[model samples]
Target: MFLFKRPLISALFRRKIQYPKSLNIKPLITFQINKMSTTVTIPEKQSVIYYDKTGGPEVLQFSTDFPVPSDLASNEILVKNRYSGINYIETYFRNGIYPASFPYIPGREASGEIVAIGSDVKNFKIGDKIAYLGNQNFAQFTKLDSNKVSIINVGANATDDQLKLYAASLLQGLTAITLINEAYNVKEGDYILVTAAAGGVGLILVQLLSKIKKAHVIAVASTNEKLNKAKVNGAEFLLNSSELSYDQIADKILEITNGKGADGIFDSIGKDSFEMDMKSIKRKGTIVSFGNASGAVSPLSITRLSPKNVKIARPQLFGYVTEPEEFQFYTESLFDLIKNGDLKIDIYKVYALKDYKTATIEMEGRKTSGKILLEIPN
Candidate 1:
């Protein structure tokens, strides 16, 4: 296995800030008040797409009529979201692929600007550009905790709203870093297999492992186009996942390794690919089952984890970000990498917030390459 950097030093972890907040960057709600709803026009209220009974895209509805705060609470920042990033997770929320509390709004990653700051909030002021990750991201104006946002500087060419919304590209990077760093403690010389290797988090994970963890990334994808995406992300090898049986795919990995299997496998396509992952992993290998794109896996058995001493565990981004130390330890590196060009995020499609059905259709059809954004009209 290939590795980079030696005697890995302790990395400083940073806490997560915010996302949908990264979309619309409003000017300071107040010049000197330090807090309060920036006192804006249009009633300081906005629109959001929501669903009561979840099933399919048709179940979604655009709501020009939505609720806004009667008062800004302490430590809260009212963000005027311009564009929100639509993710597969949101689709799962909407389509009931993953069950949620009824009548919940979807959309997770968004970038915006501060419009209102609670009186007790000091870390941020109104009008600052920020990116936030949380529920209720489909809303035009989102009130997020002051501490859950990250300040961003827009380029000269991009408007404040554009820049802030673009910041949502970092969501997968943040998630990927957290997944690799904590969920597995992935180390140098680790030969990791990334399934759905061309998808948002999959590509980001390949990049992080290649650039940060210095691991050998063997990317597995269903299409050549996706394989190319993995290639750009620093994949050491690419395996086409089409027209091949699970056993044949495992055989290919062994061929690539001269009979030795991968050290770690990140399986996202749930049941359709879980058994293959088990066959391809090396002895004492680790399997990080993250998503169930194909369908969730079945009951676990001791035989699945025994004999080879293989370690299998499922970890999600929310699991890591809830902790301050782990959150910072991972996310800070993501931004730094983006600023320095060590990572890349595709802004493949932008949709109007009301057009969520269209976005979800394209996303579920696998007709996209990177994070899709929903622009909430200002």
Candidate 2:
């Protein structure tokens, strides 16, 4: 009887026992099979905006059936972009102020999900959310090198608002952080002037210098409405450029600093504001000329900087964060600032992917202040 009872128990264990449906238990083998079966369907063709020749915003040609990029290099991952950010740099590329190959697709940064990856990619996997800095992002899909991408570090159930914030912040936020830290090494108590202070990078720069670096920030914008936005982000002083000539702005900055001049001048207006920067910067100050919004600065004699012993920099965002580690460091710092409420993302408008031309027009025409974003349709 004991042997028969033992055999019965062994047979019960050997037979596949069906758990009650209420138990909601999945077999290990079944789970493994389902996992292996999971695959992302990558579309062969995708909507894109591209231009064969550089010109105005009118040059951008959008199509619904542009071929999606394929054949990822070993260190690259393919991303299905959810949102893309617009910057003055794209205008540079589009208008031929910055060099690019013909038939160029203009975009510098985007946020997306990894739909596929090359064999060598281990740091990211299918379905990973990421914000990446790369070119040709005005499309449904972007194939990017692993080094340029930062995985979005939000909750498992992150909302669209959270994702959009990261998308809007990545490029301009990193630029602002790197500008203060590397371009000029801003210090607490230093008097810093940020031109275009309510624009995308400008507002962030104001906040970083004032709120994070504890610097006295003088915000310069074309209108009082824009200056007010800058003040809300922590600028201690506001100067309306529309109301003040460059000379007057320079005089005001000097007055604010008690005739000492600003220790650092962050200028994005390029040609139009270069002289103002020279006049407003203190001796041994650093002038970071980062954008060409008012058109690129013309050549100046290096001797122009010698009188004040002022240092000048024409730093680009990519130049400051070339290494993967450097990129990760600044990216993490930016994210932390947002998470802690130290940095606020101000998105002026989010345009449909097809409406990219209008977005670019508004951005370049200074019709908008704050980050401009494009929503990529599925």
Candidate 3:
């Protein structure tokens, strides 16, 4: 009886079994695995800001019944966002200067906790706090690839407010670090000019250049109050653009540099400052244009850079940290700076989620100085 049963089982296992072609298999497999995995009850709907067309800030519409995303792909994790950072790039998308799909959500980074994760995800579990860089973060829940998520490992005893500060600082902090390291390497004693020096990225750049890289920073801003703020952040020289014309600012930069222009110029005010950048940068200097606040820089003849033998770079933060290892290295470096008191994060304001439109308007108007954030209600 035992021999007969053994042969019968072996034959059955050896037989080829074919699944029906009409049956979708991937979700079925995921469902079977999820039944055995850890998960929390997630809401089916969430509050979100979305737009079907690109225009001014008025195009954004808030909805409390927007569907929550549940169909996470194999390397994705679902995050219940607590805070989202507002950036100038979002305004570019809203104004149609940057192409985006309709029904688009307009946020780039957020901090949250993992509520659900796909079967193949590793090193992360449900309920782990994280801050991630991804799109569609204006919603309460965001689906992100595991690679884009960074665990909030500030400390075991860190408070919720401290975590929120980390979230607000991540995107802009990473941008500043990469710009100084990769966009143009800032050497010790390098005369660097940072435009828009009171903005989110500007303040970080000023700190990294003066404090970390040991370079002399010449900060440029639109107002004296803003310049004072930049000075407190470690800028050695301050140029008030509102009080000085572009050429005058260039002249002052040269005058401060002992008749030689700045060795590097980091310009965030796009078209309106390009001429000033060209004039302020010294021979063999590099110009790093990383934003479009005043407007996109117009086309120029390549030969224009020939006279000074200058190097110009247009770098985006995402381009510099595409690999997971690159992201981790820069993120860890940024957090280390924050932890050691080498970098200070200033939150301009934390607006309620409903006030996203007002936040956008204020940031676009250049009325805010530091990082702007939106609080996502649980």
Candidate 4:
């Protein structure tokens, strides 16, 4: 029995929430074979999306029968992925929105049926359908720790088919976990504004803040589709991201609070909504700036925060997960919320695994609402 000690919770959560860790030649999951092929004439290849050169979606190409290692480890679960989800961070890494080493796999989330399990594995069994958060999901198959993937966290008992919608957004839940636990110490009836409310993180954050944190949520999005999604999830007020300037948005936010600004603003769009987040909040409000979809945020000084007796902080999963105590606290808390139906995952699109190029383009162009998935071929 591989008891999940509290110390290794981050490794387990990677199987559920975030992508694979830094590849420091570490294969927590490895494969083994009894009689290995010596000739090596035909490579054990896994079809993957890669770019020989970085430019755009056109640069991404797929190759079949890519060399897949046969060495096996006991606790790792090998999944013949049925579906994988896409996210913006993957896009940032792909479009060079953030720098990365070239010739890398592009996607972050996927769900697949477990095809094989190592000898030491427990909890998950062979042939169970599962989804996980990780890198190299662009490949046809990958290994994951059994402790990390959950069986019914999202699909069957999930409310109204919308539960399945958020399976790929395990990463979104991850970031939301950190923000809820670390930054604000949010309380019931606290008002919050989730910018990019229709986006990967904002959509999930809306529900978590409302249902779990017991806070009132205001959603800020760029489109009708997004607004509806956010509202359906739990947002009490929806503001058009495209129509509102900082002052205009601020006015609407204050109006929603009856002239009181929100207690918290979850702004992932960075500069586009930075000042608005500051202006749209009550005294001592906490503004959490995590991503840079619009652009990166520069430093903020104590002087700027002193006027309202407020605070500004950047929230990331890595910051919380680095500490085992915090890691266990967050992962357990988020899953508990999901189990109780407080936080819902919304996946707007499901593409065939072969449709990698199409999915990436849609995600990059912001064409989809919640999470996008790649259904792997069995």
Q: 31 in model 1: Cα distance from truth in Å? A: 19
The local lDDT score (0 to 100) that residue 276 gets in candidate 2 is 94
lDDT measured at residue 366 in model 4 versus the true structure, 0 to 100? 69
Ranking by TM-score: 3, 2, 1, 4
Q: For residues 54-171, what per-residue lDDT tens digits would candidate 3 score against the true structure?
A: 8888898999999998777766778888889988999888888899998898888888777887777765667777777889999999887664534442323445786578678989
| Candidate 1 Cα misplacement greater than 4 A, ranges | 1-37, 42-45, 147-166
Best by lDDT: 3
Top candidate on TM-score is: 3
Tens digit of per-residue lDDT, candidate 1, span 1-378:
001111112342222323214323232212222346465563534687888987877888888878865466676777777677776777666666788886677867677767777776665656666666766878888766555533332322446545543555656767677677666767787888898888878888888788777889998888888899889879998888786777788888878766778888888788888888888889998889888777678878877788789998888777766544334434455655665687777767778888888888777777776677788788
What ranges in model 2 sit over 4 Å off?
A: 1-38, 147-158
How badly does each model clash, as a count of residue pairs? 30, 0, 0, 22
TM-score of each: 0.84, 0.86, 0.88, 0.75
Q: Give, for candidate 2, the lowest lDDT window spanning 10 residues.
A: 28-37
Predicted candidate 4 versus true structure: per-residue lDDT over 174-280, tens digit per residue: 78766765666677888998888888788888877776667899998888788998888889998886777767989998888998799988888887788888788
Clashes of 2: 0
Candidate lDDT scores, in order, read 0.70, 0.79, 0.80, 0.66
lDDT of 3: 0.80
Candidates in descending lDDT order = 3, 2, 1, 4
